[model samples]
Target chain A: MLGDIKTVAQGTFDRYFKMKELYVILILCILNIAALSRYDVLTLNMGKEFMIDGALAILTVVALITSMAVIFEKSRELREKTAHFIITKPYGRSSYIWGKFIGISFLAIFNMAILTAGALIVFKLTSYENVMANNLATEFIYAALLITAEAIVLTALGLFFSMFLSDTITALMVLVFFILGHSFYILEKMSSESSKIFGWVSDILPNLHNLDLKSAITDNITITQDVLGYGLLYAVLYAVAFVAASSMIFSRKDIS
Target chain B: MYAIETHNLYKTFGWFLSKRKVHALNNLELKVPENVIYGFLGPNGAGKTTTIKILLGLVIPSKGHSKIFGIDTHDPDTRNHVGFLPENPKFYPYLTASDFLDFCGKIIHMDAMERSKRKDELLEKVGLTHAANQKMEGFSRGMLQRMGIAQALISDPDLIILDEPITGLDPMGRADIKRILLELREEGKTIFFSSHILSDVERMCDMVGIINHGQLIEHGSLDELRSDIGVNIHTTGVASNALMEGEKLCDYITLKNGEAIFTLTNKSDKDTVMKFISDNGGSVIRSVKLQEELEAFFLRRIQNDEKAREEEVN
Candidate 1:
């Protein structure tokens, strides 16, 4: 089973790589690197706040693009029935769910890692004296990690909807899930104004606001290890639950 | 052990509330022995694809069960010894032939060295060695079909199931596939395939099953099915009057150029017809006994089923 997952992961990665989507993401990374490095060179005295925001924007765009690419490829596979060649092999549906989730997650992490490293290099080379004074180094890394976790959860949701839904519906559904997950706190507040029971119901939706750490980093709020660990745990739980549901639905779906 | 065994298998599609139920397979009891090419004969909408899908674990059967090499079809491990080519399968267009086969080999847990070796060998066998590096998006229909075969054989599986493998190929393409299938059979692989071309099945199938309207109407060796239709006698150099009338035991008789051609429901009619020819001042230059062809047998069975259904409705 492990071998099957690895095979599917590699296959998915290669397919995406061939589609030139990865190249686009790479180009985006390069642009971010050049822009950040130029900013650092022009204003050596500029504070670390600008650097942290640059890292956040680059990673967030990378995450969104990776999710969209993964979802689009999966939809095409279903539409063309190309997935039959893979699913009918000597592997169960769980392998597919894990493989796709991990495959897309790996792409997301790899992209974020490259851009984050580039951002760090620019910061260290230009703003070495201010890096630790403003805590920009650690905060930049934390922001990248946070976005990667969010991307993992989003990848799982995209795969879940792609299993049985059409391309348009799957895209629309995933987009809605992402928007609601991030802004669920607003619903919670509105519900609390009406009744306590309603507020609890609203909380049933995954509160992705917890995963957003950009504000926390930019505001220089102290993000302890416990806070990061809790955020990671929440993302992992949601990803696991979504992937499990995808496997169950995909296993029973009629490929015809 | 049988290569494939399905006992009282059944499948139905659609829901129950204002639902349209399609009985894809109805009590289909099939047993195909090892190391033989079995032709699954049927027309469109005859449940041929459904049965293959059920056995491949693509669609769950509504009733009963099926097994491959004594292992249940529902189990993923059962596919370890099996290879399948879905009807007109569409592969990942982004993958080249080499990459596609490599992916298939990896899914089967083949070692890297062995996977590379088999990939080269299968691409050559399918006449796609030159196109191994070309992506499938530029492939023609025939090329895709050949690649499908190559992928199915990547694992060198024991049991191979193909649906309509040679439907729309040109003569040369059809012949190439036929040759490949024959070679596979020679290597002692069990092949179960469905085809609209009766001649191909008649030439290659060791055993056959005729299905219609979700039911297995006939199943046995070609000879066994042929024997049920008795014998056909074609005679020449005989007077047409000999087949004209009186004690004519032939069911269907056609005469041309003073020769007689007809079918004998029983062997006893052969001697009687010859004697009549001799008494009519004629002679039998040639007499051959031939059995009914697969096409005829298939049509007869399907027609009977349709007639029965009509009778019940009326």
Candidate 2:
């Protein structure tokens, strides 16, 4: 397991290094988000302006991009026929599924990490009294935890779609899932306001809105322990189901 | 005992609407004796690849069974002992030949020393030592194929399955692969491969199976195939009326004017017939057995079937 993890980590880091487009967009957004602090409009209440509004947008975009990373990976692997090399060994199916998930998941985290780091650097540079005085440690940890859950669910969803779909369909469907996955909160809200059928639909829908905890980080709002625990549990359960499902589907697949 | 066996193997693809179920292997039966270079011959859509795929466990047999080394193919152990190379071999383009082999070694879970020793040995055998470190992305078709062979042989498997191993090779490349296959055979490995090059099969194979239209029309040793070319002889310098209408020679020999032609189906019977003709009052003329080229023999069989279908329709 350690060897597998190491191999996956190396492969992921190597891939992240090469995916210039990803790094470029992510860095640009981090800088863009940091620069938004220049506007007093966003600084009125750090909670409402920076964390709630600004961080919500970042989490949504990151979730969407990370989900699509599944397609990026599947296209490269399927098109190049790398599966033949990977599929013929011990733990081949699981290694391929999880290795890819972690690879892209780590990349997604790195993107978010850069933003958080950038936010800290801006605080250091600007030395805003509240930004400097307020302890970012707790809120940063909360933000990290929320992003991790979001990354897990998105990665699972991505892997599920990638397992059976061809390169093109995998990419397209992941895009669809990303858009739909991130908007699950709205879907659920809309469904609840509609009919009983909608209620049932919302019940099945994963509440991604719960994953958005940027307000707590930016505005220094305290996150309830139960709420955090529920979101964590939901992400874990969803990830486990999807990964298990992908394993079953891929196990029977003919690599030739 | 045979190293590989298949009974009534049938596979169909596609379903419903466009339902173009290619009965890729229609009740195809095969038995490959252990420790021989078994050349599987076929044209396009002849189900050669399909049979190989089924044997390699890359496919599900719709209604039949196959075994390798006396073990059922669906058994995981069977795959562990068998090595395969698909037609149009595809590998990770980013990986060099050595890295690819290393990856494959890791996949099959070979111990470090064993994988390295085997990798070096296979690279040398395939003559890819100079290019081992070069990325496969720019390798020629023949190079890719050679690396593919090397990859398959990494585990030093009991049975090696190659689909069209030498199809798109220059003379030298073909010779190299044939040499390697021969060497592997010398090492007591069972090599089963398909090829359109009938001559290659004729030269390399101890046993050959020809599949066409999802059916195994013929299979046996090359000598058996040559014999099955079936008794056609044309000759000149024969005395007139050498063949009597009701004679055993009549059944075996065809007379063309003054010339007596007899295909030697059985060598011993050829002498007996000649003696009978001489004793029966007709002079024996020149007689020789003819050998049909494998290609000609294949074309004739396929053509005859077409003719039979046409006549049936009429």
The TM-score values for the models, in the order shown, are 0.82, 0.77
Location of the lowest summed lDDT over 10 successive residues in candidate 1 chain B: B227-236
Candidate 2 lDDT over residue span B116-185, tens digit each:
8889999999999999899998999889988988988888898898888898899888988899899999
* lDDT scores in order: 0.80, 0.71
Give the per-residue Cα lDDT of candidate 2 at A256.
39
Instruction: Give the per-residue lDDT of model 2 (tens digit) for A112-209.
Output: 67766765565556535455454554465466667767877777776787766765677677666555655666656555444656544543455566
lDDT of 1 by residue, A112-203 (tens): 78778877776666644565566667866777887888888888888887876776788788778778888886766777555776455544
lDDT of 2 at A145: 66
Clashing residue pairs in candidate 2 (N, C-alpha, C atoms within 3 angstroms): A47-A219, A89-B107
Overlapping backbone residue pairs in candidate 1 total 0
TM value for model 2: 0.77
Error of 1 at A176 (Å): 0.8
| Model 1 regions lying over 4 Å from their true place | A25-58, A117-133, A187-204, B16-18, B127-140, B226-287, B291-293
Cα deviation of B87, candidate 2, in Å? 2.6
What does DockQ give for each predicted structure? 0.56, 0.24
lDDT of 2 at B208: 81
Tell me the docking grade of candidate 1: medium
